[model samples]
Target: MSEAQDDDVQEFAASLTRMKERTDRSYGQLARRLNMNTSTLHRYCAGDAVPLDFAPVERFAALCGATPQERLELHRLWILAVAARQRSRTAAAEATGTAGTPPEPAGEPVQDPVSPEPAGEPALDPVSPEPPHRPWFRRRRFLVSAAVATALLATLGSLSALPDDDRRPGASDSVEAADPPRATRPGTPRPKSTKSPSPSPKTSSSPSAGASKKSSPKPGERTEEPSKGPGQQRPPAGVPLTWSADSHVWQAGCGHDYVIARSPRQVPPPPAPQDAETWAGTQNAVHGRQTLVEVSVQGRTSTAVVLEALRVRVVGRSAPGRGSSYAMDNGCGGALTPRYFDVDLDKDRPIARPADGNDSGVTIPAMRLPYRVSAEDPEVLLIDARTKGCDCSWYLELDWSSQGRTGTVRIDDHGRPFRTTGIDGLPRYSYDTSARKWVPYS
Candidate 1:
């Protein structure tokens, strides 16, 4: 194999290996579940062979509990590996001059040749003689022509018997006008058709009419601006931006606290940051006092997108939940320099503001908005929303514009808003790493 081909295969194998390691499954275990030979599975993960079909790879990813994004990345790598393998095979075939060449037969077949007749006389059947035949259409030519002429004459006779007004121009329009109009609902108005009317026969035969018909928009074609009433603002047809919000971020200095309705003894030990979402779900936990979310935004096209501002919308507020608060980490030691924004949920009208972070005595500068992102350049924003008086449910609105088009994208925890409640004076507990148990903290 060429060096490039080898590299592509190895890269795909490395991704598979990482996925396997994350699942903590052995080769024999995975092979049994996948219904494949252990050695064959090993070869695939070792970059010794590539699967001809993607079905097994997809199943393998599902078995390893891979996320949607991870599965997409894996499929992309698999495509590259398959392409490289095909190229290598083609190169080998061409080098041996066997490409597109048909294989030769092993043996030749024998056949008998017929004898030629005498120079002037044609061969005759020995037993009997047969009569000559005529084609079916040729024998019925007169009948067929007569039938066509009779049909044409009958059509002309029928037309001549019609009334003169029925044959006049715009006769069809008069017939339509005699019918009653369609009835609409009492309070509802009929919607006007967006499509243009069909041209009349007189104008339809003109060059300009044909050109206009060709230029008209087809059915279901999206318009840049949809019809709307006055004083109303509508977003452009489509925005070329994509974003995802992860609410399972770890907040430093806050000690990674979460509020749950369960007791300290019922809750398990603190999970790693990556598994925080799963852990929270198992415990039915919500962020305590504050929640830190990580938002990733990227443009789907090559055009740059300007992120104007981040606004917070308060969905609702209620009394804080009466629950026990637990801290995932006893102490977090690291410099916080990420682009961060702070939202105070206790306010009547909350907004995202640039915030600075401090580690020990070093202060980190705050990052502001009006950032630019494209297909090649993506941006991540960290939002830290805190509440002290009530349990607040809120989501973020991101204003963006690209190529004179502007729109807003909502950032939330999946389809629901992020919830943060007051944890002051609540029963607090912390996980002790050495003891491997939850310990009450003041």
Candidate 2:
């Protein structure tokens, strides 16, 4: 080997080590940015292989925010590495390559790593088809964890990949990793600081209100309870939606109009009063972004179509002048999805009206929940029509008994699919990654 070639090997090794240590990035995050994996990253870092693709490396550089000079040098080195590998493989094949040899019979065991380099340089091992695994233990687990922690943010199912632009292998992602990420509704009052440091409310009442004279605060004073802003409560990733049944019993909307509640598998006609509207439908599609499902039911005279969109949004945080902008359209009868509430609540019925609320409330189910609404999906109303309510975990009780004994639909919020007391009576689905689908959570 020439002196220059040997120098190149050492230089490449040093550069790789620098890249690994210089940035504390995880294989997952780097993969998302570069669209590659840990094993590939391991090889690249170890100078085991020059990439056939430049994307992952480029992504890493981008994450590192490499300087112009550094970027240029990286490409230059990458090209040299590739060229060397090609030459070595070519010479080895010409010398002792079994270029077209057939495989041995079934009983044969594969040999150890075969050198593809004609010289003494080590041969490049082909990547095994299986993913790389750590033993029951691994070194650098913490570093790998930090990388993964920084990236691989859990997102909703109809995945809109985070723009590669927002990602970095560094600690600062620009977007505040708030407990409950604070987002403003469109058209709502903007704070002087859009990304304000979370505020602590100033207690106004006397500190000793309703207390004995000695314990009582002055006439203008008040006692205060510990209060944290909405941002203080963020649901951790992968945490199941804790079931919280309302102490208030669910009352069907409108005194006389009883909505039929049934399971997805029963075929019996609901025991309906002659005056009740018997709703039925096929579990066609659930456009959760719009928080609505499209249902088509068959009856004696004709088929009934109903667009059921779940209503969840942040209260008080909705933009002062926004609503309906993010609701999904069911696209029925030549109508669009979220095609406006079938019956407008704002105009007719009594949706919850916050006495202190400045704007009118939009129509939704009697049970409203605070969900990552509009700020997450602009086309959905959760962003525009905001409201404040108890953080009640909810699952729409869908009765599919009209279809079959086995009709069911899994409700997936935040990519973790869970089977709620599935029938009107029991929600039982849990996400089992091992099973790769929703199993009974109960």
lDDT of 2 by residue, 324-442 (tens): 11111112131111221221112222132212111124322321222221111111111111112211122222111211111112222322211111122223233344644433333
| Candidate 1 lDDT, 10-59, residue by residue in tens | 99999998887554245655877999876677788889899999998999
Candidate 1's C-alpha runs over 4 A off are 1-236, 357-365
Candidate 1: worst 10 consecutive residues by lDDT?
192-201
In order, candidate lDDTs are 0.69, 0.31
User: Could you say which candidate leads in lDDT?
Assistant: 1
TM-score of each model, in listed order: 0.50, 0.23
Clashing pairs in 1: none
Once superposed on the true structure, which residue ranges of model 2 sit more than 4 Å away at CA?
A: 1-10, 99-442
